[model samples]
Target chain A: MTMRSPLSRVRGLGSAHSGTEHFLTQRMTAIANVPLVLFFVYLLVTLAGRSHAAVSATLSNSTTAIFLLAAILSVVIHMRIGMQIIIEDYVHHDGLKMSLMMANTFFSIAIGLCAGFAILKLNFGL
Target chain B: MAEIRTRNPRPLSPHLQVYRLTMTMAMSILHRITGAALYFGTILFVWWLFAAATSRGFEALNSFFDTWFGQLMLFGYSWALIHHMLGGIRHLVWDTGRGLGPAEREFSAWATMVGSISLTVMVWILGLTLRG
Candidate 1:
């Protein structure tokens, strides 16, 4: 049986099991982002500013659309954990640290959705 | 609560100020710094995508990026992104229990620094050529 404690409110005295989850997810996203980020560079550098129809049509391609969306998701998550680790390391003030952590969460999600929404809009035109 | 303001000053790990600056240490800090830079850069990226998706104001956005200032920022951002990526790769290599030696760390530090810059320069060169 897993040794996780049954007590719900264990005060300030226990290991936070979620740290491993955070660490592993950070690495996982980092691994995924390498290729995704490369594709993203290619997408913007080559195809971004062509004609409107060309851009839209490119996005509509299944492979391009999927990879772009995957890149968006992977990158946003990577950046979030990356920033959170930074804040945890350098920002020692309690309130400020908590606020920045929350802000990082909100910022990552907002941008992820914004990027994903944009890609979907381009792909679907709806 | 962080309890950072407790009356008794707490003992701490010796920090950057104490250590002689080494290639590995510099790369370690640069990794964090570039990571922070890329956070802001991601905002610019998301904005670019949103603009392109909406099909409105896209030209103005792209044109801004075409300007000198935007070009400088993009140059900085791309370099930061690439450097961070290489740094992460080095970390991954170290995570595998290889390349953890002091000399190996220095080698990887040099590799990350040079590799990121070279890649950024090459990519931008090709990108600008394609644009032309």
Candidate 2:
């Protein structure tokens, strides 16, 4: 077997590879976002002009609740993946890039969690 | 006699004209632009949500979103959101190292643009249909 270049093997290790990983994740998330987004659009269109109670009632439906949760989760993950790539590419400060990536992950998670909880609470009337 | 000679070698890799542009490339660029737009656009969503949650009757929110300018903003935001999502998928396929050739790349690009626009138009049509 022909030997690979040292750079070829090492190029993707650690920080360098993280960018590629992020890119892959971005694409993965995009594929995931497709169905989730379509469902979300349908959900939103249905929710248009709905009363608060009616909206809550719809969310309370197990199917609706699940759909909403899935949509939010996929979207938040997708956003995090996209932003991570942007930061890795543009941010030169090593410390700042790491810090911002961590912060972005946390924020996206929090938003997803809160949004999920809100939907659940509304649906369950708890 | 003193003479100076200089050999300007041809430029390095990635000559723009040599490689035909692909749909994947176009989509890749759109993905970035849409992502950036969505990043900023989230602020609008935050503002609208805050207005609805904190203020009375949703009038403040309604007034803002119901205005011509508000509709335009919303339209732009929706387009960005949809476009970015489609472009992101195109990127994902590229990342897998499967769709880099000329034909597939162009196909994905046109698909992203056409898909995004079609979805936008469909949604708008649905909105109009619902209203009537």
The C-alpha lDDT values of all candidates are: 0.82, 0.68
lDDT by residue (tens digit), candidate 1, B29-132: 99999988888887888777777778788788777777888778777877887898899999888879999988888889999999999998898888868878
Per-residue alpha-carbon lDDT of model 2 for B1-56, expressed as tens digits? Answer: 11233597556466547777765656776778888677655455444333333334
Q: After superposition, how far is residue A115 of candidate 2 from its true place, in Å?
A: 1.0
Worst 10 residues of 2 chain B by lDDT: B46-55
lDDT of 1 by residue, A1-126 (tens): 757674643545354556788888888999998898788776766663466667667777889989988988888888898898899889987789999999999999998888888888887878
Sequence-dependent TM-score of model 2:
0.71
> Candidate 1's error at B123, in angstroms?
1.6
Candidate 2: segments with Cα more than 4 A from true spot: A1-28, A48-54, B1-26, B39-59, B95-99
Write down the C-alpha DockQ for each prediction. Answer: 0.43, 0.14
TM-score value, chain A, candidate 2 = 0.77
Write out the backbone clash pairs for model 2: A27-B92, B23-B105, B23-B106
Q: What tier of docking accuracy does candidate 2 attain?
A: incorrect
Candidate 1 residue B105 Cα shift, in angstroms, is 0.9
In order, what is each prediction's RMSD in angstroms? 4.6, 8.0
